[model samples]
Target: MQKSLSSLMIALAFASATAPQAHAASNEDVVKRHFASLVAGPTPKTSELQMFLTMMPKGGDLHHHYSGAIYAEQYLEWVDKQGFCVNKTDFRINTAAGAKSASCVSGKDLVADNAAYRALLQKWSTADFYNHSSGKQLPPDQTFFDTFGYFNDVASTNGSEGLQTLKKRAIAENLSYIETIYEIAPITPDGDFDKLAAEGFDNARLNAALEALVPKLEASQAFQQGIQNYLAHLQKASAGVDDEQFTMRYQPFVLRFLPPSMVFSQMLASFKLAKTSPQIVGVNIVGQESLNVSMRDYSLHMQMFKFLKAKYPDVKMALHAGELALGVVPPEGLKFHIQEAVNVAGANRIGHGIDIAHESNALAIMKTMRERRIPVEVNLTSNEFILGVKGPAHPLDLYRKYGVPFVISTDDAGVTRHNLSNEYVLFATRYKTDYAEVKKLSYDSIRYSFLADADKKRLLQQLDSRFSKFEADIARALLPAK
Candidate 1:
């Protein structure tokens, strides 16, 4: 009996030692391994990866800005068509044709001059960031913000055309939706709201002052006509776009550099517009966060949003908070902007939450964000170009580790001379992220989007179908000959 037991034990040990590995490689695993191999070498071409990503189903772009998204070439075309002129000295596009400035060149002449046209492209985008032959080199942060002013008039003139351009670009890139941030122009209010704001930080007086103007502004035929024009532009832009192929929504934003009165009034108008219009989904506050006016009135702006949000609870809010870095603003400035935006203003999604680590009690904020599922819009190229933050210094991994949801985005693809595919490529190459992580980021883009529940479900279903086919194709390619 002892000998028989010993033989059985020996047999069992041998069987355990000889058995194959327990878990087989999943389809995702196989795909990830192939991806790692494809991107293995230093300075890998990644043309194959780019092709794959270009065809890969991207969900939505949530952090886009409409004016900044238009390519500089398109803006130049609009300038030429509008009979505008460009100031050679500063490269500003003047809408009025015959300005009596020595530097002003007619759009026709500028287009004819290849050198000037190329210069305009460089000035209006990050084109000169890497290669600057002449002129003073501006700081990257300043350069990025300054580009907007140069192209503002051209963008204004070509709103619908810009939308059509963006829609076509998005379709070609395989993106399904975009929540673009734009302004409903003629935002100036008849009343002097700035005077009330200059009266110091008195919330009651500001509220009273703005309340008086809301009804007047809402009833203004000009305001109503502006909304109609915006709607018509969208209709015209989306004329032939099939509803199933692509969808878009707008989040009208207020410039934070404006005075408190103007900012508040604009905020009020934005909320009212969102409440009344289906096209405008939410309100956002945008501008250089480090500027004196924006920083000084940061809390005040939050209070205004808080007030308006309470009044119109259904109006969604996405604030551009903590878009600052160390040199951009003093250390103290970084700590509270995101906190106030979240706790005080109740921002549903935080744009460019780059200063999270600098915030006081940041862990608590991360905890709150995780618990509430408050996602951050992560723009990789924009962050690297604007803030000089990337790779380990970036808070992307921190968000993942702490369970805070985030979606990859292109803040201004055209301005940066990049696209969503390039963003995914950077993310994968920089972080060595696996297939599951990459897929989740794409999924989360739509999952955390402000789209209505039914629409979100339908888009998600579309993604599932697309991914299934993608995985199947990948699996078949990876298989060995029978």
Candidate 2:
């Protein structure tokens, strides 16, 4: 009887999943048929197309980093605004003496104001990221990664303004929400930190130095109050943000290369903020995981979380695990990242689980993720940019084949020079997914999002109702006049 009841319950769940569409079947059928009719056509009505795009309910980007979301051009403009000089040959912004050096490339001199130079940088960075050009140099990983240094000055300086810019872009792309990764610290500038440490500092002394810098950090207090400041700033930027517009939340991430205790302490601080700061939803560990220290302490980091979780279980975690591709790490390191994230670190979401196919007990790992419903954050552009994985090489198909929940995300939209819309289009074109499946994927985003239960359900219902109407409208346009 219990087995029979379990079967009945599973059937009921499946039924409920389809029932809403069943009630709205006419509209869905109309869309499916209309799209089918277009297999060999010059496209449908423009207004209808616009509405469809508008109603393409994108779920929240659960794994976005703020610094990676800004447009490269915006950074350049900010650099120019700051009256900084850009190297004529390399385009590196020359900051004030003793300031952090801006990174750029070495090349023949190009007129700084030349439209071609601007376009070249745009092409090199995120602005012209979508343009496919035959003659453009295919960048090495360092060349690509180094772009951040060129713009780091503006990236750090623009802070909230930069976030606002990305937020607007998300809204334009039809994304409904984003959980952006950003750095928050009470620490002094790197130079000051080094200076203090050189002056015979220990951890306690470093803490005192940090406390001294607190006023400096807090002076911007708007940006310096750590996660709380970030929350206030985001709220201010998003104050007029509507339900139809994309919403954003903050995830305070710490560089992993820091001392374990320091990272742990910073992480604890983030968790404390998460408990009270609505905008600050959680914490993430990032940066150069392939480094020896990171790997050496991987288990220790997870154990740290296990300890933190005991104290603050509600503080959410979405981690960067298994982001490495073949040759990126030792063979032994490949098998356990996703597993450790799921089993030990208590990560609710996994970022760039690209090595899923390579892990030991790979199928079991995938099954665990499926059973747990912990979605892998899929950053198609980043995977292609960083790991050389695209199309069939990507795990998109495998994730689907195994029934592992996955959501498309932009890991570093600004850095990779892509957007949420591009990600959708990539999934559609690459996977040969029809519009219904695309719509379903979009809905799945909200359904599986880490939003509060009440909020998630409400957004799911809204997406369903909105999607149904959108399909109906498209169908009405497609049909012959009665």
Candidate 3:
């Protein structure tokens, strides 16, 4: 039988009440007890706990996407400034007159049309998706992914400016660090390589073909220059920012729906870039996992990682595995994704391991993750919006039950219309998570990050100091009035 939310809350309360009496309560424990009381009340929604969580210092967002993190309104401002046109019919952005095509509205006409502008806002974001009266409701998954395509032009053109915007937003929310997944190299496929990739998935043949391309890629001036340009853009984006207040890192990602040869080449480039660049910390594969090409090449992609990881053992990997739900794919499909990602690809972290219950020998998989200490980047809002998986059905409690570590994040925050604070609110209120658990999650974000050991230690120390101050403030706020 599945556990209900009320039962989960009762279990947590029982655990807290049963603590050993000989030990004195730490500041974190005191804060947790107080917060637990508020949550236990009839209406925790109106309590000050929301304010407390919003102001709390969150350590880092480990699964962010740079382009999808920006608001649609911001993208529109960039569009207007750059003289880009919006297609009134489909609400797509066009870069120039020739690029507008026959179906798109002219830039001047789109600017004058208020109705079209409003439609663009709704179509480009989660603005009107909940309003049944607006006649603009779309399936949540479609709305979430479609936003990226509509705003791709603006996001692609304004890399540095978008970084500045994201930095300012992160500071406002008290976020200490961000590891954003951005595309550094363009996907321009080699014809000879495409023919080889299409030849089928034989490990030996794939290995031989990939080995031949390494020399040519390394020797190409264009490939070398692309890496240089990518690094320069990041440096330009972070020019005057103080690392103490906020820090940023990049993970160059490959689109999973591409042909195997293209995916392998991108992974090769990413690993090479990580070796040479200070800003680029890791590489990840991104896209809808349920796509035909993605599902077909999933195991092949893991093999690719196995091959490359042996070659560049130091390059970090965080694969997006098991983001599917029951209706989205076959039962057999769900059984091995998370397993392969961990056992085959050797992923350091799993993004959106929501289908854990559906995996074959699910308990064994959880046990392996716990023993290995592989963390999951939990994005509550994104999972609910995209997969219709939330509440008691979510694996958040299951991960806790089995001792699997996880850190809360806002995956595509802007697209999902959520922030880090909102994620904390959902987690704490829904799971009845106490303040001590919240603090641990914050610390774990830094602990499980892709940073070097020295940097991780420094960040953890900083977090400890911040939590001490926060606990003191909480004590004063909760005191009885004179």
* Candidate maximizing TM-score: 3
Each model's lDDT comes to 0.82, 0.69, 0.82
What overall lDDT, based on C-alpha atoms, would model 1 receive against the true structure? 0.82
* lDDT per residue as tens, model 1, 1-482: 99999999999899988998568676667777877776677765478788778877899999999888998878878877787778887788877647735578766677678888777777799897776755677888888988988988877676667787888899899898899997543365554666656667577776676678677777878776766675666666556554788888888789998866567667876887787667678889899888999999998899888888889998888889999888788889999988898898999999999999999988988888899889999999999999999999898888888989998999999899999988898887777566678888889989888887888899999989878877767867888856
Question: What does candidate 3's lDDT look like per residue over 327-437, in tens digits?
Answer: 898778898999998998889999999999999978988899999999899999899888999989999899999999999998998887778988888887778677778
Task: Give candidate 2's error at residue 342 in angstroms.
Answer: 0.7
lDDT of candidate 2 over 1-482, digit per residue (tens): 99999999999999998776556548678877654443324443444444455556676777787777776667666765665655644556677754333333222223344664665475446444445444654554544566666766666675657766776777675577777787553322335644554465444564566556445443543433555655565566556544544556677786666765456556666676678777677778887677777777676667667667767888888889888778878888888888888887898889988888888888898898899898888988888877778889888899889989888788888777667766775665566556677776787777666677777777777766767666767767777777
TM-scores for every candidate against the unseen true structure: 0.88, 0.75, 0.88
Off by over 4 Å in 2: 1-25, 34-55, 97-112, 115-139, 184-239, 242-244
Over 4 Å off, model 3: 1-30, 41-43, 97-117, 133-136
User: Model 2 scores what on Cα lDDT?
Assistant: 0.69
Q: Lowest lDDT 10-mer window, candidate 2?
A: 101-110
Every candidate's CA RMSD: 4.7, 10.2, 9.2
